[model samples]
Target: MDASEINAITDWLIDGARSAPMPSQMMAQACERMVAAGLPLWRVGVFIRTLHPEIFGRNFIWRQGAPEVEVGTVDFEIQETPEFKRSPLSLVFNRGLEVRGNPDNLADVERFPFLLDLRQEGATDYVAMPLRFLDDTVHAMTLTTKQPGGFSDAQVAALRALTKPLTRITEIITLRRTATTLLDTYVGNRAGERIMGGQIRRGHTDTMQAVIWLSDLRGFTALSDRLPAETVVEILNHYFDCQVASIRAHGGEVLKFMGDGLLAVFPIDEYIGDANHVCARVLEAARESRCSVDALAFPIGEAIERFRFGVALHVGNILYGNIGGGNRLDFTCIGPAVNLAARLEKIAGRMGRTVVASEGFVRACGADWNELGEFPIAGFSTAQRVYGLADEAPVVMA
Candidate 1:
């Protein structure tokens, strides 16, 4: 490719490709543009590091004449694997080194076991370049060709020149993704979307009817007092995992993890379903959490001990939005409904029941429940009627 053609591709990266909706689409178009500019490109891959709880990074793969790019994620554990250690991507990611070789050559194939697979697929040239961001964080991009001889010296130089513009584009995409992932990880998904959509002002709350859920570990104080700090954290994580998985599976968003307690909600959306539907799902989540906690066992030296938790469910309107001091604000829900849920959770612990609910929740659920009688709540003036699952027998706590 000539100097003008390379410059055109660079311009496209800065202007056109930067606007692509996703990294996969950007990579596919970039590869197609490089091929159109007379570069012998059969396959292209771009690897970008990301900030996520589970995923370490993402890889976008583009093959010639393919309909769409193939995207995959790498976990943090991959860094410890022998395959990653021997791969060219590791060098590009860690040492910011450029790797160029003939995949068909025995020496190169021996050095990189993956090259042998490419050689079998008729790949001749392979080049991996480090895409150094402005912050000096190194990402990776690789180009492979099936052409007989491989990329020419001028073509390699052109590809290297394109990296500067490509790095900027990649950095933009990565930063956006990191921001989104971090928000979603810290706050719930719905809250994250609202914040991203510019609903960040304090006291900006929306009133919505939802099935409010509050749960707490029954003996967390005693357990934490006996166990090490790290052990307590591990146990808490395991306990929350059981509830979080079930809640999310049943269309609920966990908002906060306060010590040994958790707060979540199942919004009653007109488009999704009615109050009854949402209440039923919350009941399912509650039952699943109960069973999971019952089965959870922890070992303390010589013996294994089981743990339990209490959940309180109620259906009412809640204020969901940002609320806090000047600079640091918390995106969460608050109202009398949440307070009642908190009170009901304490009642569940006192009553030796695993799960308890308010009258509104039981009515919406339309399930067989045993009325646990009216009890005076701390904040409320009138006594509230609570109920428990009819089939769930009360456990004897030591």
Candidate 2:
């Protein structure tokens, strides 16, 4: 490609591609533009490291003639594998260096096993370059060519010239994605969306009806007193995982984890039909969590110790939004409904019940419930009715 063509592509990268909605789309368009400009591009790949709990990075692959780019995620565990260590992408990621391979060179093909496949596919040359972000972090991009004698020196130079513009665009996209992932990880998805949508000011709240979930690990104080700190933490993590996985799978979002206690909500939307379905889903989640907690066992010295927890579900209106002092704020929910759920959870521990629901929940869920009778709840003037799962027997604490 000539200097003019390269300049056009750089302009597109800065102006058009930078505003693309997704990284994958940007990559595909970039490659398409390069190929259209008479660059001998056969396949293009962009790899960018990101901040996430489970994902290490993401890769966007655009093969010539394909309608769309193939996007894939690399997990943290993959970095420890022998395959990743031996791959060219790893060298670019770890060493911050450019890698070049010729399909005709046996040593290059052997050193990078991926080259062998490229050679078989009629590829003649491959080049991987470092994409240095504003923070000096190194990412990578690879280009392959099937042209007769591979990319010319001029073509390679033009591609090199484009890296600076590409790096700026990629960093812009990566930073936005990182911000979103961090928010989603720290808060629930729905809350994260609200924060991103500018609902970040203190006292910014919206009243909404939801099925509230409050749970506490039974006998946690005594267990922590007996077990080592690390052991206690490990057990708490495993125990919370049991509930979190089930809750998320059943359309609930975990709002907070306080010591061995957890709070979550399943939002109710009038537009989405009746509250019965949402209540039923919360019940299913509670049942699954109960079974998981029952099967949970941890090794303590020579014997295994079983675990138990109490959950209280209530359906009512909650004030959902940000509330805190100064710059430090917490995006969560509050209301009388939350207070009642908390009280019901404490009552569950005293009653040795695994799961309990408020009268509102029991009525909405339409489930066969064992009426547990009215009991005086703290901070409330009247006694509140509670119900337990008809099929669940009171847990026998060891």
Candidate 3:
């Protein structure tokens, strides 16, 4: 290719890198270009194993090409420059050429059984390539063929040329998703605007007034004991889905699912509304939680008590940013206020109330609440005047 033509192709790739949401699609387009530019090829595939080993796990069909194989294949290692041994039945894992001249070895084919059937089916060639973008450790692309002879050396070179740009694009999309998920976990609300701010500085912090709600599934342990493992997971997922949807639908963020319960919050942004507004939003979430729970008719396989939820909402300043050590960090909030919310939620269970809030929350709401009385709550240094948010008259407990 001439310098001008190569420059045009490079520009097109750069533009694609900017627009594409994933590396796989971008690699497919690049491979199409390589094919158009005289590389004989029909299929293109990408594999990323950074977070999940299953991306290139054993018996993979994209590489091994055995139709009879159930699971795909994995590559523990790769050999360079040798003509790839193509098999009609072998599963290919690497990114390169699998051709007729590439002699197949029994021991190698045995290691990846997905390739066994491909050889039996009269398929002979494959090529898989590994692409690394930025600082990532497990991202690569693979190209394959069912024909007798695999792609030529020049074709492999063309495929290699597209690797860097493809990797770079993949890295960006992956990082962005990581950041967004972190923001959602900590902010406890839609943080599109807040996450946008994170792009400005690497480790800046912000304190926002937010209404935090913590709720746990009651009798979860006893319920789990009675049901089979599959039944347990199904029930938990169904319950969590219902609870989380109620929270998210009312502009609340489900921060973390703590096995049996969830933590959530509605950010009281000055630009959005006020504390009372945020509490009402949380209260709406509470009502929705009850409604959703009541609607569930899940069978526990025994005469188990119906599921119920306990919620506590508190509004205060929570310092939000990333925490933890090294690269393994979490973007979440911390402070006395978060602790208080959790404390009250626990109190709800002991006091036989579904929803409980501190006197401070009630004062912030500037509304009357059913008097549940001042009591010494565990983990709190002093007696806290708590209130019960019931559907009817307050039912006080000892």
- Quote each prediction's TM-score: 0.97, 0.97, 0.56
Q: What is model 1's C-alpha RMSD? A: 1.4
Candidate 2 has an lDDT of 0.91
Stretch of 10 with least lDDT, candidate 3: 53-62
lDDT score, candidate 1, position 118: 88
Candidate 3 residue-wise lDDT, 292-372, digit = tens? 876777754465535676788788888766666656655566778898888888878877788788876787775546868
- Please give the lDDT score for candidate 3: 0.62
The true-versus-predicted C-alpha distance at residue 245 of model 1, in Å, is 0.9
Candidate 1 per-residue C-alpha lDDT over 106-224 given as tens digits, one digit per residue, 9 for 90 to 100: 88878899998888899989999999988899999999999889998988989999998999988988987888888888898999899989999998899999999999998888998
Off by over 4 Å in 1: 16-19, 270-273
Specify the poorest-scoring 10-residue window by lDDT in model 1: 16-25
Q: Point out the higher-scoring one by lDDT: 1 or 3.
A: 1
Question: RMSDs, each prediction?
Answer: 1.4, 1.3, 9.5
Order candidates by lDDT, high to low: 2, 1, 3
Residues 193-227, candidate 2: write the lDDT tens digits: 99989999998999999999999999999999998
